[model samples]
Target: MATTTLGVKLDDPTRERLKAAAQSIDRTPHWLIKQAIFNYLEKLESGATLLELDGSAARDNEDRGELAEDAGLQCFLDFAESIQPQSVLRAAITSAYRRPEQEVVPMLLEQARLTAPVAEATNKMAAAIAEKLRNQKSAGGRAGIVQGLLQEFSLSSQEGVALMCLAEALLRIPDKGTRDALIRDKISNGNWQPHLGNSPSLFVNAATWGLLLTGKLVATHNEAGLTSSLSRIIGRSGEPMIRKGVDMAMRLMGEQFVTGETIGEALANASRFEAKGFRYSYDMLGEAALTEHDAQKYLASYEQAIHSIGKASHGRGIYEGPGISIKLSALHPRYSRAQYERVMEELYPRLLSLTLLAKQYDIGLNIDAEEADRLELSLDLLERLCFEPQLTGWNGIGFVIQAYQKRCPYVIDYVIDLARRSRHRLMIRLVKGAYWDSEIKRAQVEGLEGYPVYTRKVYTDVSYIACARKLLAAPEVIYPQFATHNAHTLAAIYQIAGQNYYPGQYEFQCLHGMGEPLYEQVVGKVADGKLNRPCRVYAPVGTHETLLAYLVRRLLENGANTSFVNRIADHSISIQELVADPVSQIERMATQEGGFGLPHPRIPLPRDLYGAERANSSGIDMANEHRLGSLSSALLATAHNDWKAAPMLGCPAGA
Candidate 1:
């Protein structure tokens, strides 16, 4: 190829700076300039702004050339250093787990401190929102199937527990033999006849009638005489009908929770909500991959979803349009800290590819938060992604922080610092958290010193508000996404965010089916009911087969008697009690108990799990990197010592 001469003038200082930046990485100024021009044109073609063509962009081009030229020790060193910030982040994350609830609560209170006047304003706003949500006409003037089921078969009741277990596990069972048995076991055990007409939901009542009849038919399978003969006939022929009914019921519940069975369908379903001024962050639902094939399958699904979603966006940009939320575990079989080297070598490259694709389309890609142990590992990936020269100026990179974790406030501080260092804004989604039950049980089983999450729900709420304050205060470096369905939490965040709102200063987030009604009162042009703030719908898109884990989490979250979504539909819960402040609740608890921010009285420490009958045996936390590292070091330290055993034949004679 022939090159044409292009002349550009620069001041002496500017020339020196360019030459120094080029020399730092051992490259000629001429070569750097040519690469920069090529990069600049490529960026322009890809729709990047002039501001994006800063020093970092030029360096990015040079770095690529360097890697190509010397693909040896220097490249390895660079990769190592890029992810080395895990040292700082790991310390922060490790410290978060198992902190004394009493200690953690006070810190959160101080961080979430609100004046009496501000509290009052928050209460008023939250109460108004709650009242409207209650009074608004539901689509059919009745509760949703899930809500109706929860109202009728509460978790405290055996029937409710049975239904939830069946709903959560039915779709994942593969063999027809097992499916039939599960249907028989779950349905036949629950007393469904009395609940037939108790629920006003046609869906719920229909489900009840099916369960009642199926139970009666399966119950007499081993009885004597006519009932037994009739049961045998029904069991042989009508079993398929029972299976079909259960399958339909599961699919119906799945449809209400999941947006669609695929990305294309999800986007089409999202259009109506988009038209109503609501944005979306689509989550492709699947659990952690247990095999490489599983990981690759999920990876392909995410890649396809990104392409389809990007096309659908039509250049609405990151903040204004839809985006994708990815689970890191879904892209790698072993995404644990113990497999740190494997993850860095394998998972990081895949993550970089996805981030680059999202950047090319000018869309956001958020890494969804998972279990407590993976927090720092995720930050390691996120830190590497942020500092990546190719992704340097892209503001579409997103992360999630679970406020229920004790380390949430500290994580916010670290993330803000990182965004400032990377010279780009990061989208941070603040959520109360999922996996609370599992986290608590895991700690108890392991005999860990303390719970990684809060023992009390109110403590988590306080932490959410406190974390929100931290995110809000750093406007330039962070774009805060508050994901919650609680009117009180929403109102407190709304007030704390203040009255003056720009297009993308900050926004609220809600789940797909559950949050729409509540947010309908908040997201539009300024009006009596609307708060005029943007709210993004976190929609899960997947077939019923992949929706098992997601559905279970949603049920556990909303089906709980104390959950905001569960209570919002119950008229017996007064507006005053419904919209009570978490901060105030904590303060009152502290005062009344005379123990400052004590843990829930009902929840015992892992050591005290058995109430003095027998001590719980200790188990290792294989997920905690710090613990694993310490154990490895200790074992290695004693490797040099040896002991020899000898026969004791002479001992008896000598004695």
Candidate 2:
């Protein structure tokens, strides 16, 4: 019989399935098909002849056994036999590959039966290990403790996996002696180098221990009044990094004042650079007054600060340069509108006198924004001050507009119209509003129709850019001081201004510590004649304690983004890395340090511990692991304490 060889043909659906299966196993479909063919051929090939002799002629006989036993030869022969005309061989092959449910179900059941005992044995081993660890812990033995604990616990599969991972880390400690040596070395050397190569778990634990130890030491020193002594020593002479950190922490925490002495030093510094065209804005700490008296005190403090700056300017032969920012709420509250009007009536006249004096000295006053309720009052005051017959000088007054407000465009238009009508030049300092969360909460509490502050930041940013362009369009409006830290937004402002041909008509402003890179970049451009606008740094001056609110705001802003935090933590290997390393600096701050710990490293208070203990005393189950971890009971206790102590403080405002 004459036989013909045929190629395999697969249907589109079957071919797609085959390709997917091959992909799943990371094999080429051609390779898979060839392998399958070889497998099938091997199963069918019995004995086969490789050659034929001429009819009726005596042939040289070759041994069939040698070739018959060859697996490759048998496969080829089987494959040739399987391919027949009109056989639908491809479909047959696919069908053969598919398992019948009847067959599969029984096989699956049998496999489960086989695996059950193995799983049981594994669990038993784990239980034994965990039990041993528990016993050892009771007997106070450290060796094999982690392994034993893992074995005894009836953990879920995931937990079991984690236990194994943790055990690997624990075993890398070498021995108790080595571990102790490492700890002792780190403590004595005052530098803890993590051995993450050994195990990630060990690295994490070691880092946590280091932070805890540092925190504990700081707390103990603070409690023992050693911090004050350290401060004194540092004040006299200390390592530059230590001095700078401590000084910054102290100044930021508001525990010390921006003293008359500090102000004098600032003036001296400014005086040295004024001849080179440097200017200064002197700000006194204290704002958010609850009463007229409080407002008056803050006002008086500003007056005093201005007077000192004036005196210093007179002596240095440098006129007061246009720079000063003031918060409106510091003048009076909205609830006391009538009283505040009277307070303002008196305060405005005095402020006008200061402005007149400042005008004579060439100092500029910028009215800063506060809560939304105070925005109207701030703008009103600004309009009056700017229009006042005595203070209409080109750069005599400036007002801040928070671009986050939905109505900022209207505010900008109003200012432009006012400038046009009054024929007085105006300066606008634009900021993205700072009190976003507070404003939203107030709106919620007051049942306001909508949040006047733009809730979405993208919208606010767009508004800011629009307002910036609008302000830049008005040549009569002084070059606005654009205060922001957002690089993209800043770049956009610059782009829009350039596109509109207002290249040299805007100045950028940023906070003191933040935006250093951006500030330097912009300033460098100005210095190199790439740009002609000025760049200003808004340096905040106050004791660290008084600046807690500001610090909190900074933390909240950074912490709002989880990705930012994770990126920071990944880069920051230690506290020093977090504080000193530029990449990890931004996200190291805790968002809510209120009850978790002290606001600053130098000021260690027992707030969290005390709250937890109080919770325990008040019938809260502090011993509950979940409660301890979550800090729920501690929070309740703190709230209760605040409620109880509020009355003793004598009034709601005082509390």
Candidate 3:
């Protein structure tokens, strides 16, 4: 069997006693400890409790300093194993997969009631904090250009969609001809004239003027007269100029969203914030690998970044220093439940390598959350990584949980149990998810029974708080990382975490640029009029070329009309409405509304998408392992079956 050294920290008295005992037996402490553990495991597997053992054996074990701790450990392990997540979690996931919103919300509501029960005083306290967050604007701090722009051109308008489209696709288009066309299409289609001087943000106003000019140039490119002649000349020359201008604008957006183009640059940029008690988790920009080459390339990037980040961390430790967030998809071409065996064989080693390196520097390595389909796969990998002997004693391994999913609460249960079993404290970052739209669309398109995510935003908020409650309650096993830009969420979590706050009981998180203003108020000494809580920045580091998807998600998240950040930016929104408790809000709706606990009326089920005319084509979930297995079995069963058939020109005699 492969073996590695494991270090156990012991106090002076314990160490002295262990040495003396080893000396008495004329055996090495390592061998003695190994034998004790092996014997304990054997007894545990045999289902024998310490109480069940003979008095003499129990006394001998006590003399060797093993019975008490081992018994407790064995009991906990047996309990954890008995309720093993594989069955419980799988059943929970399957049940929630396409459950009706009315059915799912109430179930979650009950869990929330038990987990994050509403308190009148905590609500008021959270409201007060949120009011301060809204009124207390920073003085000449780093301005959030994207926030301002998003406010000026809200996603409900044509201009906002145009901006997002251009930002998502412009720079990535290589050929100038296609790039120019995309720029012209997006710029000309938007109504920029109305926004000429309406926005207070300089960036927004400037963008409007530039967009208006380009719109005019493109709109009048073939008109007749002196104006037309000037337009022709400018349009001929302006297409390339317009393309360059759009590229620069996208890069500017990238700058606002992304920390830097490289790991070193990102680290250096993080210093200023680090000085202000703002830690960071740098995520390298890239998508899921489509090929082995892409996977290796991403792996190399992670390794290089880890080395750089580790050296910069200087062993400040996981909680106090900077860390890195890694995507499982980036590490493997197929990180899904359907490819379970292949993933276990192929991807597990790469994940372990990155984690071990991160452990070498004692910095946190968080597994970034992806789509809902991969949730189980990620948990499987996380469970394996936690029990890894090489990674023993390392508390820097973390996992991000998206509270938007229906299965979030159960997933938390599984993770907490996993942490206890592995004897490692896991950092759990709870965030209101980023893939709401995609998850909704996917479920509807697949003709799934129900959406995997909440259709209404308030339900997601309630889920986040519920999950937060669960995470905060388990401080022994979990170090909760609350990531949100909503002042209401921050305040609720702050109050829920308790009034007496320490440096790291729990911490808040925000995006690199969007969160600074709000977090600046929360992070620092309480005597200095701050919340005195630590806040980490989720900073993405990459060049403009790789910033497409991340930027789009950020824009969509912040620009939505229902977003607290968006509403906070618009002073017209009252503080009371912005700070309304999600739990109470849902309850109030339930009391008054006809269709209280239901999904959004506009988002119909897949079968009812056309109202009555047609049903959406059903698609098998390729990510589901059991379904895939059944499909494979059925295909194989019919693979060799001989079939003799012919199309008859006329009806059979019976017909």
Candidate 4:
């Protein structure tokens, strides 16, 4: 066998043993070492232990000198001395005797066992194991429990599958007592506190409980096979109860959520309260319309929503809570300027009418961004609407800016300039854009210029900070909505605003469900004059089926991107202790995989790593991200839906 030389470093005792062996072999230490190494290599190739090789006999005669001083020579001599000829021969004979009998005979026996009758028996055994596991008090058992609950709740098969996922998470908890406690808590409280304590047992139990309560369990399970299923069923044919359950689960998971009724109710509630501290932007859901007809329908639906919100608020003498947010793709996808204009022509008259009505009721309108391809169209529409004589007032119109887009800085400047010219207040809602993965994929597929989705996390964070600084610097810009749930981003904005001392002038906008504690803290401080800020929930309203896409998107954003939990755990553990007990760190990482900020199945990696390699090693994927987003989005969307729409537009034909 061909051999490669391997360098060796040896201790004194080992080197001395080698020298003695080389002397006994009656050969030069280097020559004896070479022979010893060759013999060991042959044994290795033959699958023999070095100690079982015959040539080791010679090692005793050749190594009596101070060749031990040479570490490499000592290593080879030591290896040669280990070979035992009798042991090697005995092992070879034994292997030969057993191999043919067992290996050859088992093939025929195995083939016979695979015949029809045997195959039937094997299938039966497999099925029995599966059934037993499903019913056992394990992870699979919890899955069964969720399955039963889904049936009892009359959820669709997909929804049922999603719910069962929550059950599986519950099963992952190690302690039986904690698991039982969590189940009892869920049954009694109708809510789950997944991040109760930092202990491993508590973390697992709480995460499992939270999954069930938030409906993320189902969503997480659904992540694997059904990418488009939720969106398809949303607003299509699912039962209202299914939608309600989805919404509830989503809210618990902390996502921005919306549903038709909740948005209307929020608007109505705002109007009734005459809430001067906040403004509302209503969004109508539905997207990727390939035809102008569908787009027109979308536009009409939005216009109707706008008018309904205005009318409702008018009845309550609330003039400010009437802004409506619209997605351009919902108006029509892939349209030329004129064709788009024609759809807009149909939409504009109604939008103008809504504008006229908003003038009477004092409502504002903001347009939302869609796919990157449709972004220019969305911006053009916003610009046109902003310049409209009827809606020229600063409080009456606004546009959204996705900070991740490379062009946003230019867009921000453009909007600011437009606002200056109109002598109107510009309401710019700043968001880290959605559809990041999709944008990247599309850019790659189309061979586009730049990745609008900031690949680096720091870049995105800095972009938000920079934009906030720019907007806050320009007092005429009305310090548009800072729409984010990131603590770091939020704190930075708060610090900047504090330094500038324009707290009330800027509004902090969070999704309806996410970061409730943070939102409350920020708003509470504002109320106490500690921060002095206005806050608004970008409350969305649409049917549950229609809202799942948004829900999925939110879960993806929160669960997929951040790894605060793992980092916190690592920091909490001392480096010296971690090094001494590596397994402890591994176990901690494993446990943290399901802790708060580390949503199960999509748990973030340890802080020391980067990119997809670490994520894949942890078994997290895009699907898990999507499911988390969907679950959180659904409930938040529903909460917003249930609120009364400010009556500026009529409900669509059906609702």
In terms of lDDT, the best-performing candidate is 1
lDDT for each residue of candidate 1 in 1-655, tens digit (9 for 90 to 100): 2323443345699899988988898775666887999998999999877774468978788777765644433433333222322346557766666779887888888888778877899999899988988887655522266567667777766787887888877787888888888877877888887787876678788878877877877776666754666876796887788888777766776788888898989999888988999999999999999999999998898899899889988999999989999999999999987677789889999899988898888889999999998988898889889889998778999999999998898899899999998998999999999999999998998888778899888898999999999999999999999999999899888888888888889989999878999998898877655779999999999987789899888878877888988888788999999998888788888789998668778888888898879877777776665565566556544544675566778665544
Error of 3 at 442 (Å): 1.9
lDDT for model 1, on a 0 to 1 scale? 0.83
- Model 3 / residue 310 / CA error / Å: 1.3
Candidate 4 lDDT by residue in tens digits, 56-111: 55744444332444443443443333222222322332222112111222222221
Number of clashing residue pairs in every model?
0, 17, 1, 82
lDDT of 3 by residue, 462-484 (tens): 88988898999899999999999
Q: Candidate 2, which segments miss by more than 4 Å at Cα?
A: 1-210, 213-261, 268-279, 291-293, 310-322, 333-344, 499-504, 525-532, 562-655
Residue 174 local lDDT, model 3: 83
- Model 4 alpha-carbon drift over 4 Å, by segment: 1-256, 259-263, 268-279, 290-293, 312-322, 333-351, 498-504, 525-530, 563-655
Identify the runs in model 1 with alpha carbons over 4 angstroms from their true place. 1-90, 141-143, 193-196, 225-229, 236-238, 622-629, 644-655
List where candidate 3 sits over 4 angstroms from the true fold. 1-85, 113-120, 136-144, 224-228, 625-645, 648-655
- Give the Cα error of residue 212 in candidate 3, in Å: 2.3
